[model samples]
Target: MSSPETFDIVVAQLGDNWTLTPVVFENEDYQLPDTPAPFVSVEIYGDFFDQASIGAGERDDNLWREGGEIFLHVMTPNGTGSRQARQYAKQLVNLFRGQDIDGVRFLDASIGAGDPGRSFSNYYAMTATIGFERDE
Candidate 1:
């Protein structure tokens, strides 16, 4: 499967939290809604697959590992200084860091402070990046 598909699976694993309501796992080619506030978006920005070595002069065809980073954008209403967004981003980092989804392992995760300029002028936004890998 593609990286975006993997992101869907990750969001499914996160389920939902009431503290950050209206969470959205955007599908491929999806556009952000104009009215939603205090929402979360999970998106995969990159993916990579590499062959695994089993022994000398031997590579495992079935051991190709899929890995990538998923970007999480948390947005809140304007003038909040992204306070809520930062909180939600922290929660996301705590939930996914060093965790595993099925057999997919999350190697690392981190979140940033809110940046109003990075998103809509009416919203405060914070971002998180999660790196994951799995044998496929």
Candidate 2:
């Protein structure tokens, strides 16, 4: 029903493969843990909706089709190459590809290296985009 709920569903789908918890909401302030390597986070970045039909009334009731884009951010240990980060991103993609969560169908996923300007030195950062939709 909400972004946090959707993020929890996604994390559950990731299962035992992922252990670290990163920030889930965009623009939410967060502090990173001082632990070791392999930090990960999931967030709902965007959403879209379409009205398919309108009911006949003074105030029309609308049937809506909704969808959203989920982003998974992964950071491996320092000195790890982008390959490792990409591998982790691939795993995240595989987990959600063609799967449905609470009636939300995951359509596809794309992975890529994180922005160099935003990433830290020696840290392998990658991001994955998951496309999902649902009829309501």
Candidate 3:
């Protein structure tokens, strides 16, 4: 027997409409820690919106079952960016069309704030749910 590959599952579950892009922002706001790390941005193209809407709409009381949206995942210390973030974001687009994640709130008060906190490493070994805003 063979072990299931999550990456392949991600591709199969998410389909072709979803894309993962790697970005390195030098600016203070977008900069990661000193480590040479990679963060992923998962985007659902325009065409997939229609498909996501139908499936998510018919589901039970699920946040992703109401409206369409684009989610952003950030890497942190504990829950750093894993393959799941990329794969799941795409799966969300493929499985939950027209679903809304307007109220998805992620708290990070422990990360500190202001300049001191800014100097701290943002790119830890964990992936975090950064945002889930509506596409509109």
Between candidates 1 and 3, the one scoring higher on lDDT is 1
**Tens-place lDDT digits, model 1, residues 68-111:** 87777887777767567777887888877888767778877777
Residue 72 of model 1 has an lDDT of 78
- Taking all chains together, each candidate's TM-score versus the true structure is 0.75, 0.70, 0.21
The per-model lDDT (C-alpha) reads 0.69, 0.66, 0.31
Which 10 successive residues of model 1 have the least lDDT summed?
Answer: 53-62
Model 2 residue 63 CA deviation (Å) reads 2.6
The true-structure Cα RMSD of candidate 3 reads 14.3
Backbone atom clashes (below 3 Å) for every candidate: 0, 0, 14
What is the per-residue lDDT of model 2 for residues 24-104, given as tens digits with 9 covering 90 to 100? 445666665565466566677435567767774633366666678877777776665667777777877887889887877
State which candidate has the highest lDDT. Answer: 1
